[model samples]
Target: MMKFIGEAMNETMKRNFSECPPFFTPFGDTHKCISLFTPIKVSWFEARMFCESMTGNLAILDDINTYIQLLKYIEEKVCNCVNSKINKQCEDNERKLMPRFTGDAETCLSILEENFYYFSDEWCTVKLSPLCMTNKI
Candidate 1:
């Protein structure tokens, strides 16, 4: 489902090299000044491949600010260009593709680790219930 939403919506802008991250430093300066991208609904692996081919890797989400910034940057060129609105709409658009929040009862299995306490539990919420995601049905 490589739906090219941005291009379909007639939202294409020149890429801003100054906005490029330091890791892509070399290409940004040597490459085109315009950095317009087509946001397609690609599977995780496809997305990784597309990004690697075009720029680098699938953008990593470390913090909410960066996430919001990128969403705004993409949406603004497409819509009113507001980061907040873009974030909200983008979230809504993506949510349609997400699986249910709860894990499947029988199919879900937990790994019996040697030490549960040793698990850092990076993104776990206050409760484990929020973590199990439903499949795309």
Candidate 2:
């Protein structure tokens, strides 16, 4: 995994290209920068903490384009593990990684049901990797 160096919140800044990971793909026309953490699994709180540690936020994918692109990227990454010595294990990890958290919760105002746009809050403590975002597009 390539570590990108920079503080991105409101805007995407100009940084040294050499430090940027090639896998960090820009989603659609937004300023959001996303990277998957398939190798690490943590609870929702931990996931958020992890992203914050990197000066980012757990990708609360509210944009259709961004969400779609992320899924596609993940699919490609998982598929590429076919030749790995632990191919089955890798594929299993990918399955549990999905239905990722989106920073939403079940509140008194409303109850969120499972759907393409949102996932079950029960996954909050399920110890899984999350997509981190530097900026919300």
Q: Could you report the Cα RMSD, in angstroms, for every candidate shown? A: 13.3, 7.6
lDDT of each: 0.30, 0.52
Kindly state the number of residue pairs that clash in model 2. 0
Candidate 1 off by > 4 Å: 1-39, 81-137
> Which RMSD does model 1 reach against the true structure?
13.3
Instruction: Indicate which candidate wins on lDDT.
Output: 2
User: How big is the RMSD of model 2?
Assistant: 7.6
Tens-digit per-residue lDDT, 19-47, candidate 2: 33333445456666676666676776777
TM-score of the candidate numbered 2? Answer: 0.58
Kindly give the stretch of ten consecutive residues in candidate 1 with the minimal lDDT sum: 128-137
- TM agreement with the true structure for every prediction: 0.34, 0.58
